[model samples]
Target: MSSATNSQLAIRTRSWMFTPATRPDRFANAAKSQVDVLIVDLEDAVQPDEKAAARGNVRTLLDAADNTALPPLAIRINSLLTRFGLDDLIMLLDAKHAPQFVLLPKIESPEQVLQIDTLLTAAGKTTWLVPMIESARGLSVVEPIAQSCSRVAALMFGAADYASDVKAQPEALALQLARCGVAAACAQAGVLAIDAPCFALHDAERLHADLTFAAANGFEAKAAIHPSHIESINTTFTPSAERVTWAKRVVEAAEKGAGTVDGRMVDEAIAREARRVLAAA
Candidate 1:
């Protein structure tokens, strides 16, 4: 792909901050923050009876035809098997505008992704998708789901739900395999891999360690529950100045067929990575 197109992909996969659908009071603040995407949740964040009202809030955000101040918005809707999920889909289809992305939770098969894509296409909506793999079944189908459709903009690893599905504590080591699988699938499919949020909101040390681990594991972005975590997540994912300089040098040499940078061989694969790093920067 051209550098312009690559830049678009790496631009805003850094920090995704989620706000409870019931909490419209916080929506404006969340949108104004330095988050890459502001996710309005209609799933776990809302109580059963309050789902309708929560959906209404999401629709209201969509209804604002002249609001250019909103950030890149997304909605984490309930599972397709649930009634609320159906309602969420209906609301999106019936709305005047659609969120740039939709976080499809508990995705276990490519068919499910296809179903949503088909529904959106039939309605003439070009909304992209972010399929969240948060269970054993979901992880097992990560490759297929990542490759399911062009509408998939990214793949998110929902560690909390996956750990619960496996009856284990949500530790990094225990969830490493799933995280690796997700990252690999995303890399292969040319989509962003988003790390799940750290639950220990008060443990600064733990959050730092988690961020370090994720940045080294092929994850390009991370989700945050609180605004406090946004800055750290963004800093961890942003390519360093030194790295960006090296990437530029490498790509420059590769374009001229030098195949060598600072006495290191720059192959096609390495050049591609350099391009990605430049894009990320």
Candidate 2:
């Protein structure tokens, strides 16, 4: 599709673009981009010495803008177990405008999500949680993590951290189990499953394969470390026109008590998938 077609697509969870929290020069530009969600990354993108200033930048940006003008905003805070995470939490709570999503990194259990939810509640912010599952421990309990709280919006897989934790390479084959686990858990919770951001910044072929892997395994969205990745992410996650037509046929078949659509069986699971495709479209 052309750039105009991509821009015409409404705001959905198909692509999330990450901007370094420290890059004030690029913040507004990223917000105006075609990315579905603009995340001011406070974790991996900022240095320890600059984390404080990054937090301030986020606050000032939020203070200066009308929320409606921007796409959905998210902040990937450090783990709540760390001092940096606690400080990030405090900054978000005290901000004049709350982000739509708060991405918690290195989340291994449901309790961490609950604690953050409680704090946001006390502070009167309605921000939803996006748990980043990037560890063996986190993947083990991903089901509970995805279903942790009502505010839990999505589960984002962090392959880099998982690779480090498992002493493996950060490739699709190596992280396939972790990815599948996250996707299944998100499905169980009836929330969006976000695949990890493609680190190969300019390798279009690698990015396409990565996105295909995520989609085939049930992930609904993928994160982008750079703006260039947003187009592929959006295109891959979106249901193609042909698939949408097939889904409509499947739905009609199920409603008419037909056993098949174009010779394919329309069982409960297939019918459910068709409905989901329509929803995505």
Candidate 3:
């Protein structure tokens, strides 16, 4: 709820759910939902013919709502290469009420992000941007994209689209490597990397398994197609008490300048890792 700059804040992302921007009825429900990030999807979720209407609906909904309490509002705009994306940005800048983040899809290079950032800055808008790395080109250029724009807050994995583009299955190890690549890129840039939504919505066990795998592999957050998955996702990403305790102890010992903990020396690097663990908690 604070308006602090992006760098100073920790945007907790357990479950980021995408709602169809064309469906105004779903907006109110989503605003009250438990999802960490309510992504008003104006791109893939909306039919091509309804893109215009969806954009209008989203603008109206944002205007009408008291979004101060709702989870972060993000508008998933179409690729900047299309007319729809340009229109989307125009409408957003002109509106009285604007979303906090613009979720960009199919980002292939840093130039794509720079284009969006340039437009947003020229319009005198500070809306943050998060890119979706959904293709092989995007994956390969992830590092540059992360460091290119100051407006970028995170990188989201569009696994379904990426898998189709690469002609592979989602659960494959090769896909995991691609996901890790994005995570590492985000980490290097000191930003969060989000995992794509698992398609098996009905299987809670499968969702938990996937969330656990993602958490272990350095993904700070995971997307959800359904609200039902939010609780599990949140629980999975949060640090355990045991982990927190260990981190605290390490930090405490390292603060003494030079000390040994359990037969190992606690140095500056160990202290830094401990602080990171506490921060994640």
Per-candidate TM-scores read 0.95, 0.93, 0.92
Question: lDDT of all the models against the reference?
Answer: 0.88, 0.85, 0.83
Clash list (residue pairs), candidate 3: none
Clashes of each: 0, 0, 0
Cα lDDT of model 3 by residue, 1-281, tens digit: 22222235557666789889887677668655678788999999999999999988877866765766668788998887999988988888887777877899999999989887887778888787889999998998999998887788888999999999899987887789998999999888877788999889899788878887888888888888888888888888778899899888888898767887667789888887677778778
Evaluated with TM-score, which candidate comes out highest?
1
Candidates arranged by lDDT, highest first:
1, 2, 3
Each candidate: RMSD to true structure?
2.2, 4.9, 2.6
**Roughly what TM-score does model 2 have, to 2 decimal places?**
0.93
Question: Model 3 shows how many backbone clashes?
Answer: 0
The candidates, ranked best first by TM-score, are 1, 2, 3
Clashing pairs in 2: none
Window of ten residues with lowest summed lDDT in model 3: 1-10
For candidate 1, write residues 120-181 as lDDT tens digits. Answer: 99998877899999899998889999989888888999998999998877774669889988
lDDT: the better of candidates 1 and 2: 1
